[model samples]
Target chain A: MSPVNSPLAKKLNSFAPLSPDELTCLADLQARRRTVAAMTEIVHEGQTDHRAWILQEGWANCYKLVPNGGRQIIGFPLPGDFMGLRSILLRTSDHSFASLTDAVVTEVPKHRIDEIFQAFPRLATSILWAMSRDEAMVVEHLVSLGRRTAIEGLAHLFLELGQRLSLVDLVSGSGFACPLNQYVLADALGLSAVHVNRVLRQLRERGLVSVKAHQVIIHDLDGLRELAGYDSTYLNGDRPAR
Target chain B: MSPVNSPLAKKLNSFAPLSPDELTCLADLQARRRTVAAMTEIVHEGQTDHRAWILQEGWANCYKLVPNGGRQIIGFPLPGDFMGLRSILLRTSDHSFASLTDAVVTEVPKHRIDEIFQAFPRLATSILWAMSRDEAMVVEHLVSLGRRTAIEGLAHLFLELGQRLSLVDLVSGSGFACPLNQYVLADALGLSAVHVNRVLRQLRERGLVSVKAHQVIIHDLDGLRELAGYDSTYLNGDRPAR
Candidate 1:
């Protein structure tokens, strides 16, 4: 792959510039590119010799199966996002990842991380920036599950997803092509499927948001943001004071 | 701070070896060291000149105030842990930090991170590993909130806290000096104080665990681990395949 054409280059450059040499090094990390179908298990829990990827299209989720029989959705990986990159340091995979939609990914060899850090410190910083952003998102999600009410949690999630997907150009600022069903929402928000249905109904009745035909439409974006106390700072990347 | 005497040097070297040069560089990052009283706000929400710290003694928690008036506890920062370290890449702070117990910390200037990564790639990688482990813990907490039942969540949290504190030698394998009150446990586990009271009663009745006079005693570690589906791999650092 040419450095100029690498999707990762486009992604990281959105936040921090990657020098031509760093871009070439990043492009060299990609071992292959492939598309995975929806509902496919891309990485399973406890798998050794873990692999890493950069998402180029569609959405995916990382999850851990509950001993009681269900799974908890960790976070959604979107276009220009990374999947399994952070887990490269672990001896074994701590969680499984699956596709929420048909997904395209660039397989990056986990072994090249050290080389990248040594040869291209700026690129490594950008990678760390990406991981830090991802970590912030997860922390915010934990807050939602622990503190937000059902209505508030659903609203917060939609606003977050909208802002994130908008950054990747996968959706407009107001709406997105969403593949989540009530079950997915329930798992992510720590609500029951029935409770999720009720919250969606409440949101629709209040004219705050709507989900229909695999798309999420926010009729009152400002209202939902206010209700959820949503802030985009955690998801955004800014110039670091080096 | 002398390199040989830096507590962080001892902590990081437990997982990965730091050369004398890297250790000296690491020691240079600390600007000062101080002790803080309990219930003190170490870092406030929305403060722009965000500072970073390495926890040297006692415990602190990062949390966000919910719009509804309560706060959601994000994670507890223990000895050898980094708080606000990841937020250095962020333009603004998203949450607040408070001391759960009287705490000691090493204030590390954020600007020196670029120099560390450029001069010591191995040390940068170790920092990334520590961050990854911290992120994994947050992910696990999210899983507990989303998927685990009342008993399961509390069990999971206690087991996790015990194992983590044991790593820093603050606690034995079976128990720890826990300053978390019922209110703190309730906030962390997404349960009401009343519900947390009931769960504690149940655990005590079942001879699983006990919390008394600010210390937690685990009578049956295996039972709690099984109930919580606890695994220590996420917290353990292993030799990375380069």
Candidate 2:
């Protein structure tokens, strides 16, 4: 994809308009791209790495291993999402990041980010905006896990992923490429894989949504939103007026 | 309390050394303090308030009202913690902030913060650090709700609160002023109030912890950590060396 039409550029532009010069700087900064196989560990938990990454293609997840030998997927980084932004502030990694599919990612060195921050303060502010939105998403996820029912939790996740991915033209109508399997959904929703399958089947039976292979199609968007109690305000991309 | 001895100052210092001038600026920015009654709503969800607040004394919680008339406590901000940092990025509030007890809070205007961002970039970075750590804590809480047992969840909360409070000298000998009652714990842990009481009784009977009035004392820190699978690395205050 051309740099102007890249997912990263689209996502960042939703927050604020990037100047031509700023876009060029960002493209140059991300020029050193690398590809990794599916299910590859990009950054392991407790591994101290100073470089940051931006997902150029495919999906990735940040997860932690529970004490009871279970895996908990905390955050899903889609195309255009920045991974390991916390590594710039914290000295150590608190969770592991892995590719859900064969992925293309841009590695940004620490010094380059520092230079960007010094030269382009508005760009730095946009980065902060992205990070704040990330925190808001996590907080919403907490609400799902702590209060929502199993069906509601799964429905909420689907609606969320659909909305987020749509920002970068990843969604066509109500359907999108959903690479997550039952096990990953189970870990994220805190349900057994069997329960995840059952929930999906129930949604299908209810004519709310359908999953075929790696694609998820929502038949009744309003019904799914009602069932999940999903609110899109938290995901608003409008910049706060100064 | 003196500005230098304040909990907010101490917490900011953990990220980077604050210059005397910076400390004075912060103190000036927080000079407009207000006292709020116990259980008072500081900021309601969807309210468009641009000002930011720092809890100077007493406890406060950020929570959301679920559709089923239940409440989910998203975060319990300690004495030093900043409330509604998202307000700086998002135009409207996503959740409500209420005082758990009669509290003192400092209001800092948005323009003042913008000036600070331009004048003191290191201090700005420190604020980002605090926000990142807050997100990490919420992710850990999600793990508790999704995977941990009732007992393990309560134990983990206690350990986390203790460690965080200790940073500002609020903790003493593995104990601290835990103002959270059973109902609050119920909301935070996604358990019923009866279940919360039962879990507390179980901890007391096992000689692992004890609660009297509003204080919680941990009998065995190591044993509690082992039981909760607690890791303090996420709460580390060490700043990344520049």
Candidate 3:
């Protein structure tokens, strides 16, 4: 596929337009597109090679497994997000990452990244900007885990996802396709599956949001934002790109 | 003080020694060191200026305040840690940062950072490395909050802190000077102050570790590590710099 049509290029063009030459450079890295099966481990904790990839399609969860079969889903790397960038840069996988659904990823080998950084240094800066944005999201989730109530936390997550997907033009008005199930939501929100079910019911009854089948329908985005005290400034800067 | 004499340089020198020219360049920024009183807000949420600082003398907590006066401390910035790099890079403060004790910090102005990035581009790579390390720690904590029990979480945090502090030689064999009170502990660990008190007592009884007054004494380091399942490789790379 051409770089200009790639989800990553499209996402960047939506915010900060990349030059034609930059798109061509990005296309070089996407030469090896591989499809991963749903629920397959793409990278595991303690792995040495520290593989890196750019998500071209579908959802993947970045997580860590604790003792006795416990898992913590840190973040959902949506399409257009870089998977294992930090671990790749640091040269070790600190956590495991897996495809939550059948996904397509363009593998970015370590040497290729180094080549990009040296040949096109500005690309490195842009990648770091994306990483900083990722950290902001993680910090926000940490806040939810530390303080926000279950309802508020779930509300915040939904609103944030809507805004993010909207950036890549994946979310339409009032709803978006969501692949996460109650168990996955429970893992990410630090609640049990039963609690996630109860919270979904509460949101549905209040006409805020509903996770019906495989979609998130945001009935009242304004009300949900108010409940979650959701602010988009953290995700995007004070003045986002036009 | 010269950059070599600064805590930031000392910390880096302990692991990866900086070149003489690099030290001189670093000192240019540290010339504007400022002292802040304990419990003072260095940066507040939603600040437009997006100021940045490096902790040279004391600790600070980077946190986000929710509606109705709830605060969630995402991470504690120790000596040598950049206080607001993520926000400063992204050009907005998503969280508020405050000194936990009377602290000294060296401010890095936005323009100055740009100038350094232009003059010594390699320095930019090192800063990115540090940020990646910081994210690793955050990911680990997210795991604790999501899956680990309170005792296990607290133990993991303490052990992680010890390893981090030891990198700068702030921690001795048996104990370390701890500035966090029960309230702060509760805030960071997602527990109530009463729960923190109980956990401290439990650790004391179990002969693993204890926090008393302003110090944390590790009675049995191996036992505490065993309980926490703590590993240091996440914070440091596979083969860390000596």
User: Could you list the iRMS of every candidate?
Assistant: 2.6, 2.5, 2.0
Q: Model 2: DockQ against the native?
A: 0.50
10 residues in a row with least lDDT, candidate 2 chain B: B233-242
Cα lDDT tens digits for candidate 2, B1-242: 88667787787887678999888877887787789999999888877678778898999999998887888998899988888777865455678999999999998778888898889878877777787677778888989988889999999999989878887889887679988999999999999999999999999999999999899999988889899998777776433311
Model 3 spans > 4 angstroms off: A48-51, A111-125, A240-242, B1-3, B19-29, B46-51, B88-90, B110-126, B240-242
Better model by lDDT, 1 or 3? 3
Model 1: per-residue Cα lDDT over B1-242, one tens digit each? 35455656776786788888987887766536689999898777666574577888788888887767887888898877888776675445567888988888877667677678778979987787787677778889998888889998999888888877766666765779998999998888888999999999999999999999988999998898898888777777643411
Name the DockQ score for candidate 1: 0.50
- Candidate 3, B1-242: lDDT as tens digits: 45567766665554456788878887777888789999999887777575589998788998887786887788899988887776666556678899999999988878887787788766665676677678788888888777888898889999988888887778887899989998998889888999988988899999999887798999998899899988777766555523
Q: List the residue pairs that clash in candidate 2.
A: none
Model 3 backbone overlap count: 0
Please tell me which predicted candidate would have the highest TM-score against the true structure: 2
Reference-based lDDT, residue A167, model 2:
82
- Cα deviation of B111 in candidate 1 (Å)? 6.0
Listed models, DockQ each? 0.50, 0.50, 0.62
Model 2 TM-score (2 dp): 0.92
